[model samples]
Target: MGQYPDAYVQYLVHFHGDRDYFECHEVMEEFWKAHPEDPRSATYVGLIQIAVGLYHSRRGNRAGAVKMLVSALAKLQPMDVRTLGLDAEELERRIRNRLADVQAENDGYTDINLPIMDPGLLHRCQTICRDKGLVWEAPSSLENDALIHKHTLRDRADVIEERARQSRLRKEQGEAR
Candidate 1:
């Protein structure tokens, strides 16, 4: 049970980040079945549903997307897992954003856009620069440079930690103002 949950969580992160929505659903289903009563289980399930909705949306299945996303939002709306392992607030924010996208599509809006970024590219750039002892002054400029090598797991973790620290500092400074 524990292994399945952990594996599911890993798969969730992997597939969600990679935009493999269907795989995300398949992975999370394993955990959802084992712990239907757990609040976190609902959170994972809701996320998978959201991903599936997104997949449907990309395929131009507007009705299917709306149905799936609405159900997913309903499932997520009652949960209070802000202090849990998952970022509940962010998940809700994403759901709301997706719902808006679906609404726009359904309403015949032609400019509907989704915010999707390539994590692998970002990681690769950061790792390559760090490995070469290159310092990046501007975060945005990192994308302009060519990636020379792939990032090791430890290097990737360090980059993530550094970015988190910088984000916290910015947040604290903003709060103090």
Candidate 2:
């Protein structure tokens, strides 16, 4: 969490661009694994929980949303959200608001605009969102039959290849030991 990892920026890309909340979890989890000993690992995990919670909320999974959001808040309690380049107070407020709705099973999933505190980072995220034809902070189409829910319908050859490569590296390193 000291020098923000490249994965965090990539997480923002998927978050704003594709609205692929699952990928947000993957990228951040990978980074968190690399720094398990970091004192702030809980903050990283909390962010992943936020992503998954939002994903569940969008899919109308009220129960799942509440569980993840509650766990995330607990993990986030001891840390300052600004330490991760986010507007800490606003994020907590948004999470709490979302949680209330989730618990009630009434309000729909709201677009959580993670207020990035750093001007430069916000500019970069905005530019990328523009390039991708996505509007930052816009609520995604969540109609029951919408295509976003079927994201796995798209090909993921690149991801599979990367997983295979990483598996080989780990197997080889173990043999060397």
Assess each prediction's global lDDT (C-alpha) against the native.
0.54, 0.80
Quote each prediction's TM-score.
Answer: 0.50, 0.77
Residue 98 of candidate 1: its Cα lDDT?
Answer: 68
Instruction: Output the lDDT of residue 106, model 2.
Output: 79
lDDT of candidate 2 at residue 143, scale 0 to 100:
63
Clashes of each: 0, 0
- Show the lowest summed lDDT stretch of 10 residues, model 2: 143-152
Question: Which parts of model 1 have CA positions greater than 4 angstroms off?
Answer: 1-4, 37-39, 77-84, 106-177
- The lDDT of model 2 is 0.80
Q: Considering every candidate listed, which one attains the maximal TM-score?
A: 2
Among these predicted structures, which one has the highest lDDT?
2
Candidate 2: misplaced stretches above 4 Å? 1-3, 77-80, 143-177
* Tens digit per residue, CA lDDT, model 2, 1-177: 345667887788777766778888989999999989877788889989999998888888888889999999888843457776787778888899889988888765566867788877777777887988887766667763433465556578998999999999999999999
